[model samples]
Target: MSGMGSKMLELDDEDELKDFRACFVDDRSGVNYLDGNSLGRLSRAARDSIMTAIDQEWGVELIRGWEHWGELSFAIGDTLAAELLGAASGQVVVADSTSVNLYKVIMAAHSLVPDRRVLLADLNDFPTDRYILEGIAKANRMELRFIATAMDEPVVADDFAPYLDDDVAVVVLSQVNYRSGALNDLAQIAYTVHSVGAMLVGDLSHSVGAVPIALDDDDIDFAVGCTYKYLNGGPGSPAFLYARRRLQAELTQPIWGWFSARDQFTMAPGYEPVAGIGRFLVGTPPVLQLRALEGALTVVCEAGIERLRAKSLRQTELAIELFEQVLAPHGFRLASPRLGPERGGHVSFEHPHAQELTSILLRDHRVLVDYRAPNRVRFAPSPLYTSFAQVYEGIMALAKAVES
Candidate 1:
C-alpha cells in the first residue's frame, strides 16, 4: 500500500463495480481519469441513444416531433425524481443549466417570502452557488450573508447551526461541497432553514447520481442539479429543477417561453405561465440532448442509486487508504474529511504546487484530476464506471509526481 510502482492489478481485482466499468466509453485511452467530479465518462447507453436521437428523431421526425419532445423533460424528471430523489412524480423538471435553475428557484423562492431579504451561504459552497447568490442579491438589492465564513476551514454539517436566523429568506447549500468533497445534511439543514421561517434551496449537482435523496420525505422546498456529472448525461446536458408540489403555487415562474405556455398550439397573445413545474421552462426543450440524458439516466436507474452509493464509498475509501499510505510520507496533506457523512464520492488533497503538479501529472503521467484555486487536487471516483485499479494507480502517480 505504501509503494508507488504498480497496484492496479490487485486494486481492480477487488473492485465490485468492475463489471459495470464496461458500461462507459472510457475515452481516456491510456489516461487514468480521476475527474468524475468535473465531467463523467460517457456511458454506452447515452452514446447509442444520442446517435439515434440525432439521426432518427431530428432527421426523420423533422418539425413534427413536438408531441413527444414536449414531454421529454417531464418524463426524464419523473424517473430521476421517483428513482433517485426520494420523491413522487410532478416535482422535478429537466431544463436549463444548474445556474439558470438556481436563478429561477431563488427568484421564485424570494417572491414567496417577500418580507425576508437575506440569503445565506457557507464558506465552502461551490463557486457557482456563491456567484448566483451574489447576482440574485445584487439584482434584488438583498443582502448575501457568508455565514460561518471567516476563521473557518472545513466546516461540517453542524457548522450551519449558528447561521440559522429569522431574517434570512433562503439558505442555498450545496448537498456536496465542490472542492473538499464534503457532504451536507440536507434534511437537517432544510429543517433548520424552515424553523427560522426561511425556505431551503439545495444544489445536488454532486449528490444526485452518486448518492440517494428524499425530497418529499425531507419536505425540501426546492432543489436543482446538473446531469453531466454523476448522472453521466454527456457534457453540458442541461440541468433539472425541483419544486415541492404544494409550494409550486406560492412562487411564480420567472423563466418565460412558448414551450412553457398553457397552450402553444393556438399561438395566443397573452403570456401565461404553464401549470406546476412546467412553468419554469425558459425555452424549447433540447430534444436530442434530453434523449441522450434519458438514455444515461436509464443506466443509472438500471444500476440503482443504493448500489451506486455503496460502491462509491468503497472506491473512495480505497483512494483515501492509498493516499494515506503513499502521499502522507510525501507532502500531500489530506484536506477532505474522513467521516462518511461529511463526504461525497470524491476526495481532496492539498499540496502547495497543485497547479504545476496537476499539469505535470497529466502531461507526463497521463493522470487526470481537477485543481481548485490555491492548492487542492480533487479526485472524483464515479461508482458506475471507475475501478479501484484506476484510483490506486492515480494515487501512485500523484505520490511520484510530488516526490520525484
Candidate 2:
C-alpha cells in the first residue's frame, strides 16, 4: 500500500474509538458517508432500543408505559447534561424541536428583561434560529438587531462589540457556524453579553455531539440543540433545551400545556407551570424517539465527550490536510477554519459548482456529502463511526469528481 494508505491504516489502528464502528450498523453499499454533521448514522443500540420499545413497551405495556415514560425526558436530559453538555441536572430536558425550544427559551429570557427593547443575533445564523428570533421581536414590539460577519469567520466578542448594550436583552449565537463550521468562543461571548446585562441564547444544533460545550461553566443562560445530527437519534428526533438553574425560577416559556403544569397528573384547571426544566415541555413527549435518543446517548456517554472531541479534532485536521493536498488544487477553497480548535467536527470547501459536484459525488462517485447555498460542500468526520480511511477516500473522490 502507498504511504498515505498506510498512514490511514495506522491512524485508524491507533484510534480508541475505532471499535465503536461495529456498534453502529455498517454501510455496505460501497458509499463513503461524510455528512454526520448534518445527520449521523444510525447506531445498533438505538435501533434495538427502538424495536424493544415498540414490541415490549408500546406493544405489551401500552398505557401503563406512561409510568416510566413520563420521566424519560428528564432522565435523558440529565444524561445529556452530565455527559455531553457541561450542565447540571434539572436544567435540561429532551422535548420539542430545536426551533420550538429556541422560541420558548428566547421568549422566556426576553420576558426577564422586558425593559430592554432589542434582541441581537448573527445575520448569517441558521434560518430557523433567525426566523424564531425575528418573529419574537416583531410580535413583541422589540427591535431585532443583527451582527454582520463573514460567512467563513467565527463570531467573536469583538464582532458583537458594536451591538452589545443594555438595550440588547438577548443575544443569539450558534456554538458552531453551520455553513463554515467555525467554532465560537462561547465563554468569552457569554461574559461580554452578560456584562451588558443581556442574556445569551445559544443554538447548539451543529455542535452538540461533535463539540464540547460548557453551558454552566460558560454561564450560558439558555441553549437548544437537536439529537438527529451528531446525537444519531434518527430523523425528526426530539431536541433539548437548557436554562440556567438560577434563571429557571423566573423564566416562563410562552407555551403552557398539561405536561408543563405543576402536578401535571392532577390535570388541574389552572396553568401553574412546573418549577424546573419540565416547565419548558409543551405537550406529550415523543416516547419512541426519546427512547432511541436515550440509546444513542448511552454510546456517547460511554465514549466520553472529551475523547470524542480529541478524535474529532484529529479527524478534521486530517480532512483539511487531505483537502489542501488534493482538492485545493481543483478549485476547492477551504471555507472552514484551518485551525482545529477554531472549528467543529466538519470541514467545508467552497467551489463554484458545489451543488452540481455534490450531486455527482452522491450519484456517480457514491460518496455522501451535503451542500449549502450557492457554493459550499461540507464533510463531517464523525469521530465515533468514520475512519481515517473513509475521510481520505471521501476527499479523493471529491477531487476526482471535480477534475472530471
Candidate 3:
C-alpha cells in the first residue's frame, strides 16, 4: 500500500523474533490487529492448556484436582513474578479482578493509616481504578484528591510532590497511562509517597509484560494488575496483587474467605488470616481460566521479558515513524511519548474523528485499533507475536481509512 511496506519487510526478515508469530493462533486472515493493549490475541499454548485442564485435570482427576487447583494461584503468580515482575516469590499472588484487588489494597492502606483523611490518585487513571478508589473514599469518609495531569503527556513523579501531605494515607498511580501510553517513574513516585508517611499503590495493568517492573526494588506498598492485556491471559482472566513481605503481617484486606484463612479446611469458628500474600484471596479460583493463563505465561517465559521489551520498543518506533510520515499529514497528532523508554508498548494518535475512524478501519480496512473518549486511537504492537510487517500494514490501512 505504501513504499514503507518494503522497508518493513526488510526489518521483519532481520528480526530475531520473526518466528514468534507461529506461537499464537493466527485468526486474522485479512486483518491487522493493533489492540493488544486492550486484549491480547489467544495463543496455541493457552488453547491446549485449557483443553488439558478441562479434559484431563477436571475430567480424570475430578475431586482430586483440588489438591493442585488450589495452589495454582500462588504457583502462577510466582512464575509471573520470576519471569516478569521483579519481586520475590511469596510477595505476589494471582487472585480476583484488578478492581477487586484494588479495593482490597485501598482498604488495607486506609486501615494502616486510620488517622489520615485523604487518598490521592491520578485524575486520568483507568475508569475502573478511579471508581474503586472513589468508593473506598466514600465508604471511609476520606477526602479523595485527584491530581490533574495533561491528557497528551506522561505523569511524572514531580506532579505528586505538591499533593503529598501528612493527611494523605495512600497515593494510587498507574505505571503506564492507558490513554497516552506514557510510562511513569514508579521508583520516584513510591519514594515521594513514602516520604509523606503515606503508602503507594500502583496499577500495573498496562505495564506488566509490556515492560519491566521492579515492585520490590521500588518499595511499592501495594500493587494490582490484570493479566488479559499484556500478560495475554485470555478474556476476563484472574488478576494478581502484590504486598511487601513486611506489610503482610499488618495488611488485612476487607474480604476474608476460606481460601485466605490460616487453615482452609479446618472450618474454624474464628477467621485467622494467613500470614503471607495468600491472605489477599477472597474465594474460589478460576481453574479453567487460570490454566489458560498458565499456558500463556509459558510463551512469555520462553521468549523472555527483556527480549520482548526490546522488540516492543523497536515496533513502537516503527509505528511512530509511520505516524509522522503518513498520518501526521492527515491531521493526526502523536499522543504517546516520542521517546522510546518514556512510552509503553502502544502508540496512540489524537484525531478529530477517532471514533468513526476506528470503526471504519475495522469494518473496511480490517485493521483493528481501539478508541478512547474524546479523540484517541491506540495501536498496541504486542512483541510476543506482532511483527514489523503487520505494524506497517496496519498504519498503511489507517492512513487509507483517514483518506476515505
Clashes of each: 0, 0, 0
Per-residue lDDT of 1-404 in model 2, one digit per residue for the tens? 27999999999999999999998997888788899988888999999999999999999999999999999999999999998899989999999899999999998998899899999999888999999988998899999999888878788899999988779999999999999999999999999999989999999999998888899999999999999998999999999999999988887789998898998788787899888888998999999999999888888888888899999999889888998899888888999998878998888999999999999999998999999997999999899899999998898889989888
lDDT, candidate 3, 232-342, per-residue tens = 899999999988889888876899899999987889999999888889998999999999999999888898888989999999998899898889999999999999888
* Backbone steric clashes in candidate 1, count: 0
Overall local distance difference test of candidate 3: 0.90
Which regions of candidate 2 fall more than 4 Å away from where they truly are?
none
RMSD of each: 2.2, 1.1, 1.1
How much does candidate 3 score in TM-score? 0.98
Question: Candidate 1 lDDT, tens digit per residue, 1-404?
Answer: 54433456665677666787788875757888889878878889998998898888878998887768888999999998999998889999998899999999998888888989899888567888999999989988998888654211344446666766778898888888787777777888787778788988989998888888988988889999999998888788989999999988678877778878888678899988778888889887888889889888877888888888988887788778888888888888887778765678888888899888899889989999999988998888888878777778788889889876
The whole-model C-alpha lDDT of candidate 2 against the native structure comes to 0.91
lDDT winner between 1 and 2, please give it: 2
Per-residue error at 160 for model 3, in Å?
0.8
Off by over 4 Å in 1: 1-11, 26-28, 149-158
